[model samples]
Target chain A: MSNLFANQAPLLRTKTAPAAAALIASAGIIYGLVLCCINSLETFAVSFLAVLLAAILALWTFVRMAVKENDRGLLVTGAACMTAIIIVTVMPEGLPASFHVYRSFVAAALIIGLCVATLCSAVYRLLGSTPVAFDNSRYPILILPIVIALISYGMILFVLCLNGLPQISWQLISTPYDPANAALRGILNDILGTFMLMLLTSIISLPVGVGAGIYMSEYGGRIAGIIRFSTMLLRAMPVVVLGLAAYGVARMAYDTAWQGILAPDPTIMIGRGTFLLASAFLSLLVIPVITRATEEGLRSLPRDLREGSLAVGATEGYTLLHVLLPWSLPNILTGLLLGCAEVAGNVTVIVLLCGFGNYGVTPFTEATSLAHFIYKVMFADRSFRMSMGNYVYAVSVILLIITLGLTIVYLVLRNKFAERYRAH
Target chain B: MPATVEIKHLSVSYNGTNVVKDVSFEMPAGKVTAIIGPSGCGKTTLLRSINRLSELTKNCRVQGEIMVDGENVLKMDTVLLRRKVGMVFQQPNPFPKSIKENVLYGIKAAKIKTDHSDIVKSSLQKAVLWEELEHRLNESALNLSIGQQQRLCVARSLAITPEVILMDEPASALDPVSTLKLEESIQSMKGDVTLVIVTHNMQQAKRVADYTAFIYRGELIECNETEKIFANPDRSETRDYLEGKFS
Candidate 1:
């Protein structure tokens, strides 16, 4: 029996052992996170934000003085961003109003003067790093994200304009919205907010993470065990954790101290408390996919492809943009698609951090999203009936249809680009 | 038609391990320059450096100058330089695109709007695929025969109107007839561009190269007029390699 088992071991292969071990390890990790989540251990957003910011500062200094924008920046940025997000989220009560958090859609961008100023300063500092390189022709790849932003902004603006929904800028920011109008407001708010979040952080991370991934595979080689390790660590982090941090710390001081008409005012969003927090948390949950996808896109390319491009006299950046990126577009898109899909399904963080209860914001409001709406229907009580109305199957079908529609669109565009490049 | 490539004191190392050391040579104008040697010879490295392709590798560090047309290609932008210095890879790697697009990629990226019809016809004409593929310009390049795909790649490279064209064992993948056709195509492109080719087949090298540089390990052993190097070689290693004494 031992001899037979030994002989059969070759067929089973040693790889299966590590894979099984990894599966068990991951299951343990997930179980632990879920346990932590279920225990309802309050994680304050401020501490994580502080840690993230400090880590970022120290990392930036190290990169400047030692590593020189080294391969680790992606991991660092991803971690810091995720950490700040998760901490701010999972533990906060007065998340937005107390913390001076202003959820900026397009209109709110004008008030984003402070942010733009900081960005401009960073841009200058960044340009200072490589003064004479002058090879930024591939900067246009960064421009594609702006298309998403513009379309999101444009669509929202067009809709608002079409519906004559005059945005209550100052009133909405500070006042408790009338209960009658809150549902329409919440639905409108959720869709536009999601579009903005997706366009901004999620989209940016896709290129940077995936671009890094491509770079890693092309150059990381057999010796990049450290890179592989850290990437795995970062990708393994839970999303609920990330979202809590972002929501808690950044918006803490600005959280509104609300007073009720019937009683003393509660300190939070006009009427909605947890909904916005949930949205931010969901963003955190989607990072691993983005980073991994980016890595995959970079690594999957053949060595000869890189060599061929370089042999023609294209620089690293140029080769990446023109050669590797174009080829890896589908992969990058896949990563983003998966991330978006995964994020769309999450209700845990939203339930915990955002107000998804009788007293909190309702999905019937314009700012509430389809996912939250579904959750609202599934969980809410009806008159001795399944609280949610009879639109469950239709809503699910719509979600599936939307995903399918997007996938088809992506595949079609990829084929067109490929077709555009194929030679006779 | 005439071009010269000059390499001086070139050293390339990948991850602190020297891959090519003290390599230097020059190819005469308007002639086939073949770098022939055993496996791991720095011939490919030397060819790659001429167009500054060596610099693209992350761990690769190169020290020296490669002069083409009195210009240090390393100092210039590689994208522009690569457009001017075409390369045919060891494997036929046609972009996952259509035949028409592959031929016009360089032209299109050049952002110079010209008559599409004229450009496609002429580019295919130069590659000798115009008649055969005149109807199939819309077909996927990936679906074509390997030999045809390679020539199409050659055509794609030629379409960009590069001054120097480098081929890394272009016919290594083909059968005899395909090899014959490739040789014929090279014959047609002889004086149109400065051709630097790396090949293992001595017969092919003799048939195609006007000047030959025999490299061993990471060093240039001998480079001279192809006839002199073949008939009256200076180095025993070159003779040994030519006569199949040892790789």
Candidate 2:
């Protein structure tokens, strides 16, 4: 026992310097590697692309951390997306040119990253659990660097594989949107199309969902449980199954409404009646989410909320609108995002209903989505047909990026809305 | 400021069982009436019946006539009736809104067009919380201490300009400081509004009550002045319940 204290002191001290040395060396190695990559890569294509990809990934990661930090579960999901992107860079194709910039920036970032992480870890260890010494708000702004590093590290592999994954840069802003250039238009079109679809669908669903949620919560009574159960049961069936059901209904509508791709004819194929089919499909895909979310939100609202309003002589209608709906907006929006997230991936149903093979025709013929753009990109050049596999990986990144962006944006707005209306 | 609430042989039932059985009481003008009883006696039920607040209960059924401010409250439009009969809960339940908003809840809901500053100022002053909270009126009501919240609730009730205010053990959830503050406010509230409070604290009943009613097992046991109830009671049950003997 006498020897134990004396022996342990030097041993502990010795262990400390080595750990610190290892961390320093690792950061130094990353910095050196990044600068080397930046110096070697001289191409406009790969270098520029790598910068764009890295920055977007980092921004998405930062928002994901900030908005969804309410739960630890998002960490797993964030790690997975980052790791997947990393794996993409390390693959055979090599990252896009933008990777060189990303790596260079990352190497620059390592020093800042090491200091921030160490400080935060110490803060949490020393004061995080203790009461008077610290609080969540008083914690440092060090989270920013950590998010950037994780994103840069994960994107490194993608940059390597894509010939260079691009972190965001002024180049995108400088790059003109050239309508005459089909290649540029394809990328732009995918982005615009996804954004518009998501925005419209979300707007339509919010009021309808929030109102329904407030009503069912406030007034659903004994039947609310049953309404909730059936919605969950529906959710239990896969989204594709639900999407197929929408597809079938759409097909029947097309056959009934337009026989020859015009009104009053009843024999037209599914793709001809695109507008009606899309709306119906969109509604069916998202309504279940709206209904289910509202039910849970209403149930979760404390009884005192309603009672407080009612006691003040506000009728059920006023209480429901002003008090309940505003309070439940954040929760309801999360549900809407879930719906949006679910429906955004309906490539199978879209393909089947549109009757387009792999690539989408124009909206007048067969409107395709960004998700399906890879098919056209790879196959457009017969020489690149064998490497279509790369396109798969590339398009997947884009899809994930969009999904992550929408999710993060919606979540952040929801939180701000919740905070703004929080009772007073 | 004089108001009369007459409840005639009122019986309240929940899911078919009588919780308040044929209770009758007349709350005279310009006085504080306290309904004192053990847990689950008809005191709270009786108070809720007066304003038809019991209507909030899904299965609650009431067979009685409640007259307040010349309108039979039972037959009166509940939205209108509730505006006249304000209530404070056992816990301080301020809206998660600012103190100003919480105070304005009833006024805005009823769409009353009273003088804004004077209405707000007087109401807060009436509840005796104006000076302490004057600087923080825009802060969330929930941010206030529990005692201040109770007083804020009183201010909120006063803002509605009700003829009578019902409190279901208003001070029960408060610490002694808050409880005493509420009692002082209640003492100061008389002659301005009819106050009906249900409490288990017999000492609190003696503190500010002008008229006292003791309820037992969903039945009315006694009704008298505060002096008679404590010193000389007409019933043995009131004595047993008040004396620290078995209730």
Candidate 3:
């Protein structure tokens, strides 16, 4: 065991020189091997140089471990693995071209295994003692899954920014979309259309969701159970089914006398697709989210708040409005913003509604959304993807920013309310 | 003016089982009355019946007449009954609003057109919290300490000008200093509003009550002057309970 004072200090701070060197070399090997798997000839040359440098560092540390009579099993294993990687990488030219593709995979697997072993041994030496090592390993072991998840999300964001930032421009954001004209092509129509859809969806869903939630929580009865069951059923039903139902309803409205009264010009509102129809269906998608959130929020409040208000002679409705709703405002807003985000990113209902990009921007017009545009431009035609894939990526980034921005607002508001109320 | 409460043949049952069986008592007007009993002895159940708050519970049945002043509470409109008789819970439950707003919640709900500022001032003064909280009337009531919150709750109940106030173990969750402050507020509200406090603390009952009622196993064992009940009780069950034979 290490000295008591050394144990008292942080493990990383107390790491010996050899341990630090092994840690750095192992990290370098893992990074270099990842670069080699990128499948680009230009990066492969640079990646080999990185591997060579890391291998030299590992070999030097092996000599130091041998001289100091320290743990040498990991160093020996690391050196042998490095040798195997270098041989496989260098001898790829001697095999058939088809065999060369598999060469890098073999080298990457070997290097990853070695780096993992070297890192474990280095950390073990830093931790010291069997019981201390076991105790300390728990932190990283438990945190590893979340760390991997975060990295995956980070990689996606990084890739989006890399491919989309340069494509973004004032023209792309402000001009109308024109397929034949490169300079005139833009997503401005879809951007405005998406916002309008979000506004309409919220307008349609908020009152209904809040009312249903209040009924289920405050006036729970047989009817409330029925409402709860319907909401759960709606939440479980697929969006495509909602879209089809919307389509059938729109078709019926157009075919009947209502269309003669509402739409003398069929192009205005009675077409196969319109913003109003898409938003109505999207609100169906968003209602369940808001209702469940509102229900959960109200249910979580202390009974004392409700009983206290009622005890003061406030009617059930009055108490709900004044005490119950106000106390659970943060929770309601969280669900609202989450629903808004869901509305902003949804494409399925709109895709079934219209092949948007031809109509003017209005609630009754056939307007598309960012999500729909991305799905269309990416999957509708291969040639369009090759020429304008960057635009698709740009739309993705915008949609991500909008949704993430709403989520952040919800979190901030929740924290503010949580601090102010500090509910008992 | 403070109103007297007359409970006769009152029995409360939950799920077909009686919790308070054939209990009857009288709480005099303009006086502090304390009910002391063991846990689940129907002290709280009887207190809630005064305002019909116990009816909020599911499968709960209440039978018999509880008269406040002259009217039977069982047939009274709940909103009107609750406004006439206010309540305080064990934990300090201040609404999540400014102190002024919380004090005016009942008035606003009842739509009573009155001078709001005067009511706010007098209610806080009556609860003995005006000096400490006057400057912070606009602040959220939840920002107050537990003790202050309890007083704020009292002020809230007072704002609507109720004739009776029922407190269900109002000081059970308070610290010693807060408990003393609450007791002082109960004493100060005497003669203007009838106060019925339910407590397990024998000392608290003896300190704040003008009259004491002892209940055991959902029955009213004894009711008399506080000094007399503590000195010489009528029922052996009341004496045994007072001696801490069973709690």
Lowest lDDT 10-mer window, candidate 3 chain A? A6-15
Q: Please report how far candidate 1 places residue A273 from its true position, in Å.
A: 5.4
List DockQ for all candidates: 0.22, 0.42, 0.62
Give candidate 3's whole-model lDDT: 0.79
Candidate 1, residue A300: CA error in Å? 0.5
Model 1, position A379, has a per-residue lDDT of 69
Candidate 1 local lDDT, residue A184: 26
What lDDT tens digits, residue by residue, belong to model 1 across residues A271-316? Answer: 3323334443454445556656666666677776666555444467
TM-score (all chains, Cα) for each model: 0.60, 0.69, 0.83
Sorted by TM-score, highest first, which candidate order results? 3, 2, 1
RMSD of 1: 21.9
Candidate 3 structure quality by residue, lDDT tens digits, B30-123: 9999999999888999999899989889999999889999999999999999999999998988887789998999999999999999999999
What is the CAPRI rating of model 3's predicted complex?
medium
Runs in model 3 lying further than 4 Å from the true structure = A1-136, A178-183, A255-271, A379-390, A420-424
State the weakest 10-residue window (summed lDDT) of model 3 chain B.
B238-247
Quote the positional error of residue A304 for candidate 1 in Å: 2.7
Task: Please identify model 2 stretches exceeding 4 Å from their true place.
Answer: A1-185, A221-230, A237-279, A353-367, A374-392, A418-424
Report model 2's TM-score to 2 decimal places.
Answer: 0.69
